[model samples]
Target: MAWPNPFRRRTAKTVSHYGYTFEWTDEHLSEEDAHKLRFTYDELADRVLARLDAISPPQKQPPSATATSTTEKASSVESEQSKPASRDLYALLRDNKDSDPVLRELWDQVTTVPEWVDWPQIGRGQDVFYRYGGPNLTGLAYQALLGGMGGARVVETLARTGGFSIKVARRRLFETTQHVLQVTRSLDALEPGKGEGFESTVRVRLLHAAVRKRILGLAQARPSYYSVAEHGVPINDLDSAATIATFSSTLIWLSLPRQGIFMRSAEAADYIAMWRYVAYLIGAPTDFFSTPSRAKAFMQSVFLYEIRPTQTSVLLANNIITALHHQPPGYASAEFLSASARWLNGPQLSDALQLPRVSLYYSLLMLGQCAFFAFVSYTYRAVDAWDRKKIEVLRKVFWQVVVESRYGLEGKTTDFDFNGPGLILWGLFQHVVRPQLHWSEISRCRSCFKLLPARESTRMYGVHALII
Candidate 1:
């Protein structure tokens, strides 16, 4: 009689991804993708179950084979495992990134830079980033995570490091804010070389290089679950493309009108183009999202094929909401964060993530915030000089409130490094050096709980200030 292994879990049915039916072959597959192609879903299930059975307690041999078992264990040790042939992993990763046919095919089909897309016009687009569309950056970050963490590999990796935990909120928000500022500054740079430098900073490049190295190493180390040979990169070119599209097209462009904020077509195009350029600098594939329309289409395709409702997504979203619940100035309540997420990603995604339903009053409050912004958006474009000036004052007040909400008026920060493996290391460090701060006891912002701050006395806009 055999004892059944509980670990030998089987999925109810094989779910096909949206783009899986495309006539791609083994030659076009990554080692990870190709490894999967070697077996049908049923065969793979059978193989997994068989492996589980072999390792099951019932299958253990008697003590007579102890010597053989010891010898096998010695060989199976991590230090004794046979090393692969000497080759550059970085070179291999670059080759994979460049040679991926699926990504190349998608790029060719989707990318279309318009003839009138003036590269210079992107400079003017920075005004919009810090002005009308600033508050929605948080929503965009949530959207990116919602999409990126859909993959089991990414979510599991993030989960193990405890990065998605509540204690890491300040660090995460700061890093995200840095990235946002970098993109905005890069677009507004006067010198081509200076602009390139901002995009390709040593810290930024090192951070990207470190991340790529870690991801590939993770794939190599965890072959059965995560394989570069099987899946390629965890955050592959397509994922990066989707991320760029989500930020530039989906969150920025789509959210504006839905939130009742308005922008002229030309202004929107400039904004998209600016982000398209940022996408290139971030090592996302060139020309894949050259136009706003292409970005939208790419986002749709990615959401269908790559993004899905998974336990992993829910776990990450839980972490984000918990973390935001702890962070400074405290206007962004857990309820507001949940509601904003629902507003941005829709009810299906919100429910999939197991977020609590926001109350009707909060929903109306969210709409009111949007309406106020929509008024600001329109008033900024008024022909009269004084009308526009008053709007600018309002925009300044909003910006001050946002900054204070995240980092406070003095912007006090912990001495942790903001570059290299800082975030990665910090998240891991929290498990040991855990600071048990009582989040709810922290003081709430007077502005958010009370009336809006006076526009005349708002702080000067120095942090990532717009050239306009």
Candidate 2:
């Protein structure tokens, strides 16, 4: 069944979102993309798992059938149905790339770069993440993950995994954060076969496949466990597209502006392009983010079309805020987190999710942060040296991440231990302090307003206008 799209249209192809309207080509969301919900990554990761399971079947086995050659393919299908949880696609690729045809093909497919990819642009894109480190971190934490609980499919899968439960929500948040931080570590880090970014991304794909495979098995054995018809296959293309969009488009347009930080035209394109490459590697549709405008439209469409906040959304949102409360000395507070949810997601969705009200303390902190970020962003954008210095400080704060293996998969796990008063102080002031004001006019002021009342005052005022 095709999931109804609010933006799917024939004539005008325009949709209203949060008081703004966006128009995209009919190519944006096709019938094929819609039905992709019923499918997962079958060609590579799924195929590799199917083969590995039979070669090394689980220790437990069902009674052998009396039949033989006539049912060769049938038995392969049955073996897959009750296969081992996974054979560690990454390790299997490492151990058997030369010996296993399927694993070799899977590795080859992901490592090869498409003709459209610009290596230099990809390198620049990696820099964009760290360039505006504080706002991006804030956006991912407050808006992307927490705000994303409104999705029916993504939220449902996360709920089943218990990753977002109060007990492990904090760990879940850091685990995800670590992947992002690692992926954008450096330009060289993104090169296929050599970079950790490429390796991490491929490993992450297998984890998603594992979740889908496990959940599919559960649903088959107990039909009531999950309704594929209703919820779509776990982490399908649209969901994957939405996941990457949350990290890219949402941060560029919605989240950063909420903190009074804005990207230049080139900066915005580079950031979107960076995530587009990630989408390509993970089997998500890359065309959706081919340009800055297209990426923004995709995010707006997902926001209006996909967000259907239920009680589950409310529970997850609260869990996220509570899970990160008082994380480190002077680092974070409930007042800040609640206010951030209210600010980043807007009052309507936040209220729908039943997020707590923003207290006066939250308001004052937001005010202080907006003014500070605007100053910082403008000051650095105007001077190259100052920009580097700002990024250095911001990097030190978020770079305090630790990588760990979980569920018996190396390079497939992420955890963070945030401590130390000095680190906490810098991180808190930089990322923990929340900002809610948006200043769009400030973004273009350098070119728009150069002439002013006085000569010397004009340059400084022009810089200030860029931050206003």
Candidate 3:
């Protein structure tokens, strides 16, 4: 007994560590507890079995087969994501075979416009007054009357009326109607129908018919598809005909300077309509104030008045207040505003010298870089104190310029602000706030820096970089 220690004895009564020893007892686990224990045992056993299996053997498989499977899955995902969400004309036609002939005719009439018509060749740029001059005056005047009753009304109306849902429709109607009036005024402008004379050609007739039908269809679809505010108030609740008429008149007035090239009133109107329609479809504003210059001003104001100057401006204001019992150091709101104002209004020698049209685009690119820097500086200061969502919204508005500048629809060279907005947007992207999310394609295009020959790259880089 003294020779053998009980702890070290190898005997049948000694329990083996690796093996289970079952003993019957009166105590019993509840169903849940028993199930949990069983599950734990199963998991442990499965892990053990897996380890044993991994060390036990290796399965032979074809590398090509595995690669093909992975490739197929990736291809499937890419295809699904790449497909456009909207229905095409042909598909819509095929789907609506059983509909009324009138509706079908309307659809056919609208779809007749070629998807890729050479808009410039069709005299798309005829209305110089409505396109540029009128808007410029209005925008300049509007900007001057800062924080007035008129300004308040304008802001309120715009805020209430313009939203994601009805924006496209409103834009379409505004653009098309304006162009129609412009072309109507310029009798010598190109006609969509057959060639040149008073007699309507098939192309012109077809185009006109298509435009009319599309307009009608848009009108009909408005009630159903249009977005309403929380109070069920439609964005375009204002008198449609009056609003559109005024808008059209304003556009025609702006494009008056280009009247000579349009030659005919009809051509000018058509061209203006097409141009505005295209702009609207691409999520652009119809007026100059909505342009980058104005947008920048608005953003600056928001940052100064609503964001930095207020107690609620910073991300960590509340946190700081709570931690320090409301006796935390006060941020210099005025200093921040002054700094931002200086950045915005700062004189740059480059802007004074007018470069060639192509060179001008590059200048915009530089401005965009400046904007990006401003955004980074501002955001960095507030990041610790602001709500993530609020920060993101501000960032998005700023970055929109960058994205729009790069991917926006093409516009004419004479439309400086239209194209320049993209440059301003680049500035906004760079300065206002950094976007929390980014598209690689957009980023790549924005990142592209080169001053190519004006003639060669104007359309290429200009089209790709700034809004046309």
Question: Model 2, 118: alpha-carbon shift in Å?
Answer: 1.2
| TM-score of every model versus the real structure | 0.59, 0.76, 0.25
Ranking by TM-score: 2, 1, 3
Report the number of the highest-lDDT candidate.
2
Candidate 2 accuracy as lDDT = 0.64
**TM-score: model 2 vs. ground truth:** 0.76
178-259 per-residue lDDT for model 3 (tens digits)? 2332232333533332212111121122222222232334445784432232112211211111122223332232112111
The candidate that wins on TM-score is 2
Residue 467, candidate 3: alpha-carbon lDDT? 15
- How many clashes does each candidate structure show, in the order listed? 6, 0, 55
How do the residues 1-468 of candidate 1 rate in per-residue lDDT, one tens digit apiece?
011235554454322242111122222324353233222221221232233223331222223333557667776575544743322222222234245543233223223333544667766565556455434453454455543456544455455334565565445545445455444543444233334223232223224334444445556677664555444454445545555665566655545655666567776677777766655544455364666555555555555455555786687777777776635543356776666556655565567678779898767665655555566556556645744454355344443443334443234322222222233211100110011212222223444222333344332121112211
Task: Name the lDDT value of residue 138 in candidate 2.
Answer: 63
Off by over 4 Å in 3: 1-102, 108-247, 252-468
Which of candidates 1 and 3 is the stronger one according to TM-score?
1
Error of 1 at 322 (Å): 0.6
